[model samples]
Target: MRQWRLAAALIAMPALALAAPCELKIGAMGPMSGSGAQWGLSMQSAAELAAAEANKAGGIKINGETCKVSVVSYDSKYTADGAAAGANVLAGQDIHIIIGPVGSIENAAVKPVAARNQQLAWNAAYANNALEPRFPLMFQVSPPPAVWADLLIKRAMKTFPMKTVVIVVPNDQTGTDVAGVDAAAYKHNGVTATTEFFQRGTTNFAPIITRVLATHPDAVDTASSAPGDAGVIVKQLRLAGFTGPIGRVGGPGTAEILRVSGGLDVLRDFYWYEAVPTDDPKVRAIDDEYRALLGKDPMGGTTFWSYLPGARLTLKAVQAAGTDDAEKVAAVLRTMPVEDPNIGKGYWTGKKQFGIAQGLFFPFGIGIIKDGKNLGVERQEAQPE
Candidate 1:
């Protein structure tokens, strides 16, 4: 019996040695095919970059062992249903945490699924005060759209003597949310906001533009999605003879906005609220690397300044947590605040950005398209008024 016990112990020792000392997997979901595909794809690359950098540095130390990281990516095609489906699939796997479902509507739809699985979701586009009451496992890094809306209104009020604003939003739920925030912000700022809704695929904005133009508002505040939608709206507005500065709140297509706008010099001085800036050194390095690797500037895809910092923050939290357990990592994430150069120079207090005050949060950067082809970023610190 003693001999048998010794042999069994020896056999079990090797198995234990081969077991991963520690391991963690971060799941990323985005629209790789649909309208929002560019944001999703870009985020995946950024997460991969962070993961690779972490692993190359000898992985993260967790508990008493070094934890290896694995990245799992899925495409949500920019739809709420798609996001929920992708979240379900990823949650079914042995993932330690999740990164995104790019848009706010998608985030809202899938956050409950993450809660059901007792996992963490660091969604990219959610910044609403309302989210706190819903999903506890879910956190948003971007400033609430209402804040951006207020900033834009303040900008317009200062830059131009504008008295009225016309708001255009996507007819979808996400767009509706964007409009709601914009209205709230305008009211808070002592300005009146008139809103209009449009379907996602609608190309002809003649009627809507005409109606808004009739309102003869001092400026047009657009809350549609990406460059494609915003570009279409701007072009149609211009064609309909509206010359006021057009603004977008949540999803603005900084990369392809010019191209999609038909090079009509419409966006020459166009202003949109940006989450980060492209000029940060770390962001610049990543952009340069991407340009070298892709043989062209990564247009319409993930750009360093736009959507990837959140991924880096997630990885950093995992590294900081030093464990693969979802709950443990989630707890660490709730309190992790990042000041990465790539994100901007401002500060994002985790308490203000995340409901639990223990998740990852970073500063928001405002960007503008200047001289036809560059994103000029500005840093501002303002709480929701």
Candidate 2:
């Protein structure tokens, strides 16, 4: 009788396992390799980690059933074409709602595909104004870049009284947008800036640095995406004997600057637009998990900030909607609250802020680069800057 009872229990194990429902598929897209791979990879990893944790907690409860969440990640290669292709592929799948392809460029590419399929896309990167012109089935989770500049300028003015400022920007869409924001902020702060713009891959900075030095500016700012670009720009300025505070609103955090610039000492006195607060328990947990798994801090802020929130929030929306119906799932996501580790908790809406319904709306966090090696997070704010 004892043996028979044991056998019955063993036989029921398979049925119990099969009873667990797996209905929803969560998909993410980003560049997992090449020059822009860091952001995509980090977001993908963070999203997957969140999904796994959610599943361990008995998955998402919807309607009368509990469904397990599975994640699908695609590499957009940081190109619009790659983003579009990934979106096309995923649109053909059974995913309820999609998280991201990290880069603003990728987001722009994928937006149309998402709209066609009635899939809701959450823009996870910084304030990507270029994507503003296109209206799609998407919402933002952060404030715009204009708001980022507003916050930085406000803080800097309070911290240091400045008379003359210089604004340097990359000749890309991002740089142009940030440069405008900085200019307006400086004007509002009772300062006039000497503006200069450079092409994205320009190897020569001596002339531009020399020109800025001759003006004897009190502060300098750049709106470039690449950490190496910002680091090299600052180092070149230092080598040219310019002794002013440097701040890059769009640059990677201090760690990446330190790695590529040979050391952070040469570029110690700068402020960064940090997306996540270092003190947040969630942020710390992510850092710990990322370090444990990858053996390094996630390289780019854009990657982690965009990917994790996109993944987590999208999952929440799917769970809320209770089914894999893309339209309904996306609709639920539009109304869900975003409790992002990076930006704190906020709702994503693009229509009111960006003047377009397809852009992402999210919060921005600020940080300071003290000494030569640390990124001290300042604070998280709901305002755009």
Candidate 3:
């Protein structure tokens, strides 16, 4: 009798395994406890929201079985070592889809681990060139600095036409790249630009403001400044008696900039690359939902819009490929057109630029702030052809 029972138990093991529900784990890794904490937190929140919505709709189908989705987040503290540690932790848990490591340095640290593990790294930040060839599994979800700079400068020239402008950038890799792109864009548009670099943790912009004003520039471009730093620099520029137009050549952070500058009144003649259209009904709905979930307004930057499409694209690719395999999903993504609620419609492109078709090219909105109101203007595919 004992031998017979043992044989029956061994035969039922496969059946029991088949009865278990598959857990599809997605990882969100970025700086959650440093100067860039807000950006990381926003990315994680957006990923969770997407997962929750998918699970509510009976989850995603994989291998002819329904699998429940889960988002696991790790704080990388915006450091190289921290990002590597976080990547290792997620890779150990068999997480194949990762949302972000916002900066270039952090992304560089996590790239090897993602490649070794054959994981998909969906980068919502880090627009430095030559990323796709280095890591086939990595996808750039956000528009690069060159794209935004070109649009902003072109619009500014057509609308305001400043002959000479001053550019302020943070002293970092992203800043350097943004500065170079902005300078080139300005030159191409028949405008001259003088650049100034400030330390990352700079609190006082008086000296920089003084030097910038001394240049007698017709406009000030803070295309590479972080959200907080942009606010400080703009406020100081206003107080220092320079009353020209201000252009932010980076992603939108208007709400935070307004708050940091005390009010919208200080931001006259301001323009920026908006993450979403101000009048898009879909954006309003998502923003309202996000506000309810977080007890505050959504992030004023691309953080609020970048991750949703990535998550949606991942889910769609998994459903289409009928498996959760990273390579298969990535292959599907290369040929898929991504149309999310807030991010609008876009397709993956970059064959000539990055040596791979891994970057999302979408129509981005350019917002003009006048008298505390943000007005949206659309730009169709500002990227190079």
Q: Which candidate is the best by TM-score?
A: 3
Per-model TM values vs. the true structure: 0.81, 0.78, 0.86
Best-to-worst lDDT order: 3, 1, 2
Residue-level lDDT of model 2, residues 50-138, one tens digit each, is 67757877888767678777778888876779888887787777654666756566676777777777776655545345345444456
Q: Which ten residues in a row have the lowest lDDT in candidate 3?
A: 376-385
Clashing pairs in 1: 31-37, 62-322, 333-358, 333-359, 334-358, 334-359, 335-358, 335-359
Model 3 TM-score, 2 decimals: 0.86
Q: List model 3 lDDT by residue over 1-385, tens digit each.
A: 9999999999998999888678888888877764466667767876777777678778888888888888899998777788888888988998888887777667777788888888888765534662668688888766666656776778766667689998898777767777877888889888998899998778899999999999999999888576777888889999989888898886666666777776767987788876555456666587676665446665424456656677778777888888878899888877776577665777666676667778776666777766555556564443434
* Shift of residue 301 alpha carbon in model 1, Å: 5.5
lDDT of each: 0.66, 0.65, 0.75
**Candidate 2, overall lDDT?**
0.65
Q: Find the candidate with the highest lDDT and give its number.
A: 3
Tell me the spans in candidate 3 whose CA falls farther than 4 Å from its real position: 1-21, 33-35, 288-302, 371-373, 377-384
What tens digits encode model 1's per-residue C-alpha lDDT throughout 203-253?
788888889988888778766565566777777887777777676666545
Q: What number of backbone clashes does candidate 1 have, counting pairs of residues 3 or more apart or in separate chains? A: 8
